[model samples]
Target: MKKILFLFVLGVFFFVPSLSVQAAEEFLYICGPCSRNFVPIAEDVIQELALEDNVHIKLVSCLGACTASPVVEFKGEIYGHMTKEKLFALLRSYFTL
Candidate 1:
C-alpha cells in the first residue's frame, strides 16, 4: 500500500507539470474560410520552422474580418493579407529565429 502511494505521487509530479507547459505554449489561429488560399502556406511555414511543439495552430472559421481575407492572429494581434514572406517574418519575429 505504501509503495503504491509513492508511485502515484511520483506520476502526478511528472504529469501535472507537462500539462501546464503545453498549456503555456503560444497559440496561433488562422481564419479558415476568410483566409481561404493562405491557410496551406501558413501551415507549411509552421512545419518548416519545426514549431509543431512550440506553437499550437488552430483553424477558426472566421476572424470576423471578411475584408481582411487572409487573416491570422497570434497572441491577440491580428495580421491580415498574409503572404508567404509576411508569415515567415511573423514567425521569425515570434520565435526570434
Candidate 2:
C-alpha cells in the first residue's frame, strides 16, 4: 500500500505540471465567415513566426462583430479590421520578432 501511494504521488508530481502548462498555451481565434476571413493569414503568420508550440489557431464561425468583420481574438482581447500586414505586425509584436 505504501509503494502504491508513493507511485501515485510521483505520477501526480510529474504529470500535473505538464497539464497546467498545456492549459496555459495561447489561442488565436479568427472569425471564418467574416468578410476578410483572415484564417489563412493567421495560419501563415503563425507558421512563419514558428509559434506553433506556443500558439493555437482556431477558426471560429462568428465573433459577433460584423461591423468589425475579420476579427481576431488573442489573449482574450478582440481586434477588428485585420489584414495581412496588421496580422504580421501583431504576431511580430507578440513573439517579439
Candidate 3:
C-alpha cells in the first residue's frame, strides 16, 4: 500500500513537466484548524522557509489535522506534531531534492 501511494505521488511529480522545472518554488504548506497556537506556528514556518532559494512556504487553513495542532503538507503528504526546527530540516532536505 505504501509503495503504491509512493508511486502515485512520484508519477504525479514526474508527469507534471512544468512542476519538475521549478520544483523548489513548489510550496511546503503548514496547515491545521485554527485553534491553540497553530496559526502562529504555521505563519512562522512560512516566513522562515520562504526565504530559501526556489522554496516557498505558506500557512494553509484546515488541513484536517486539528487534533495534531501543527500539520505540514508537501508533495501530497502531511506531517503532524511539527516544530520550527523540524520544518527547517524538512525544507533543507526537500530543497536539495
Candidate 4:
C-alpha cells in the first residue's frame, strides 16, 4: 500500500508540469448584440488569423461590452465599435507578418 501511494505521488509530480506547458494563444473576442451580427465577418477574421499558427480567434455573444457592438478584445486589450474593415485590417497588422 505504501509503495503504491509513493508511485502515485511520483506519477502526479511528473505529469503536472506537462499539463501547464500546453500552449494557450491570444484571441480576438468579437462580441456583438447577437452572434449573427458579426459571425460572418468574424469567420473571415478567423480564417485570416488562422493563417498564422497558434493564434485563436472566436466569436462570442454579449461579452458585456455590447454598448459598443462589435468589440474586439485581444490579450485583454479592449477595442470598441469595430467595423469589418477595421477589424480585418487591425487583425492582420497584429497577427500577421
| Candidate whose lDDT is highest | 1
Give me the overall lDDT of model 2. 0.79
Which clashing pairs does model 3 show?
24-54
TM-score of each: 0.68, 0.65, 0.53, 0.53
Models sorted by lDDT, best on top:
1, 2, 4, 3
Candidate 4 lDDT by residue in tens digits, 1-97: 9999999999999998888854446666766454346667766766766643445567766676657766777777777777777877776776553
- lDDT for 59 in candidate 3 is 71
Cα RMSDs, all models? 4.7, 5.0, 13.5, 6.8
Compared with the true structure, model 4 gives a TM-score of 0.53
- Residues 11-82 of candidate 3 have per-residue lDDT tens digits of 888888755554446766766354336546545655666645554556777778777757778778887887
For model 1, residues 1-97, the per-residue Cα lDDT tens digits are 9999999999999998887734237878888787757767877888898887777778887787778768888889888877889988888887888
Off by over 4 Å in 3: 1-23, 35-53
Which stretches in model 1 have alpha-carbon errors above 4 Å? 1-24
Candidate 2 stretches with Cα past 4 Å from truth are 1-24
Best by TM-score: 1
Candidate 3, residue 19: Cα displacement in angstroms equals 16
lDDT of 1 at 27: 76
Residue 4 in model 4: shift from native, Å? 44
Error of 1 at 8 (Å): 23
